[model samples]
Target: MTNNDPKTQYNGIILLTSYLQRVFVAETIYQRVKKGHLGIRYSEAKALLDETYTILPVVEKTKQLSVAQKAQLQLITEKTLALMKGYFKQMPLSFNDKLALVGSSLYGEQMMNNGVIRLGKLFNVEVNKDFHMRTQFYEDRTKMVDFLVNSIHHNEQPDVNLVKPIETWVVDILRQKDYVLADMNKISEMIGF
Candidate 1:
């Protein structure tokens, strides 16, 4: 019963998900789904999306959905948000706060993009997304980092205290020997979403 891969994947997925939930206030399920950063399974996505809506109180506001569909959404959102927020509370950072910080850093354009970039590199392959290519990850990372470094160089910002550390942290974690690579199903289980 060698479940290391699954376990690691699950852990990574949880880490990644926690990162996103902390970074941004997913206004809608579509926002979460379109991320493509997790490479999560549909079931996992469905579960997590459902969970997020609980605290947000916005997931239930869809305009053209059936009552049954809406009800299901409410349940999932509440349950998932509860579990994730609770499970990862002991970290130096709260999931939502970290997510908010990341969201704020990118000025809303590339939310969680830094983490995705690092994950893509650690996986040694192109992430599963149509918007950004494998090479784009490197280019984007370098451009973003270079921009930050140069900002400090010019004293334009005087310091790169915003996202550089998060980018570094992501890269370091992905490189850890015990780090897990996640798939969707396991991710769903970890969050209980």
Candidate 2:
């Protein structure tokens, strides 16, 4: 589908969210290992994080995107990259510390589910269904776009202060999953395409 198509745009938003979720999870794993939380050796953790870093560009490049793809996607690519960089810069002492500040932010249910599945495949760790359920919920794309726009415009280093609003937005969206789903269903019915 063309970039201008609404369905295509919507799907792009979904994909962007998925990408961000993966980035967050990767960073968290890296920090966890570095902090001696995971059982893996330091070398192994570093190797895994390095591999993950390399794989990310491949994931971005795998899709043959148009020049207007980022623009059409509401600058999500730039914003997400900036967010990741900011998080890495901040580098909280622990994942729980970050979670406490952000409150299960950065991904919805599907994104978390997909991330868990990916992590399980890559690390051979059992999926934590409870953790997945606790974090899973739908996010509103409009708010996401707004958060990106606001966050990217800042000149300072990315930190909990800068990202907290994003987490709050995510939490709020997750809380209204039922209403959002109902609205989506109504819109689909009305479009009837």
Candidate 3:
């Protein structure tokens, strides 16, 4: 969808943020391996995607992730986002530069598969081929992280039960904000600068 469309725009941001979150999770695993928490190499993370995919419900498939999955997902997403935030803090980079840097790694594939590029399209961000190659690092990155951290926070609380599919949370948030039209301007405002 075009970036001017509010529905598409907001959803795009959500998707992009979500993909970034997943990439963040994979990056965490990579760090873990670097720190000796896990012995696997960065190249092997893609295999874990199936495991994460398994945790998702059958009927809803990708969009209708359960509350537990959402929580687990959010944890990894938040942690990864924080890590990226910190990384950016240590060495300043614009969004494009950051995308290029991390996108060059193995994990970028997972971000792409999980809709990173698609989300970027929503925002009119142009990520290149080298950025695309990094998904391999992120394939299982989302799931492996959720599985590891889920045990600690799975039962703590529940996500808001929005009637629609989980993918539509951005739309839901927009709707909640009274941006009924939800076009590109509204979405851009909702996401802020």
Candidate 4:
């Protein structure tokens, strides 16, 4: 990442942004936590990877701008690129601790079931090897979210037909027989920037 190349840096930014979008469903806690959002898709990943990744022109646009504008842009871009880097160094809870929290806590986000985030995990491999590296935050998806999207069948929506092995989590919660966000993932604490 220290290569100082614009395109390379933009690729990093794209991967980080996509990863964060898939994981938290929002960058900072302050952003709107959309509960039913389907999340990042494979095509979206490819589009994002291919689009706005040309940092050269954008950086060039700042050349004629005031020093303050350039400084601000630089600050924002640098911070965005480094967003998940801090979490990388944190000491992960022990294996036992992680196991204990698996079923009870808001650990990590679901990737495969909720969204095309499964592709986000493998975006680098599928698209470009230069995309970006995966972080520790993506290791295990402990918590499931997005009830309406993750649900196999809806009690209200009669058209929803699902096969065996996949039960209706939404229906389970409605009948008070299971747990859900109750749409609570919509709540977010404002990020202090």
lDDT of each model, Cα atoms only? 0.39, 0.42, 0.37, 0.30
**TM-score of the candidate numbered 3?**
0.29
**What is the descending TM-score order?**
3, 2, 1, 4
| Residue 36 of model 3, lDDT score | 39
Q: What is the lDDT of candidate 2?
A: 0.42
lDDT per residue as tens, model 1, 1-193:
1222323332334343443343233222223323333323334544564454342223123212234533553455445444334322234653323333333223323423544454455545575674355446545544554455444335464244646564555444435313322222344443233
Candidate 3 stretches with Cα past 4 Å from truth are 1-63, 89-110, 113-193
lDDT of 4 by residue, 1-193 (tens): 2324333333333333333343233222112222343433323433433433343245344323234433443443344334323222123433222222221122222322222332334333244332233223233222232232233223332122321111333223224312222221111110101
TM-score of model number 1: 0.25
Best by lDDT: 2
Worst 10 residues of 2 by lDDT: 184-193
Predicted structure with the largest TM-score when compared to the true one? 3
TM-score of 2: 0.26
Per-residue CA lDDT of candidate 3, range 27-129, in tens? 4534432233442322232233443344433312343334464445444334433333332222343322222233222233353344546545544667676
- Give the candidate order by descending lDDT: 2, 1, 3, 4
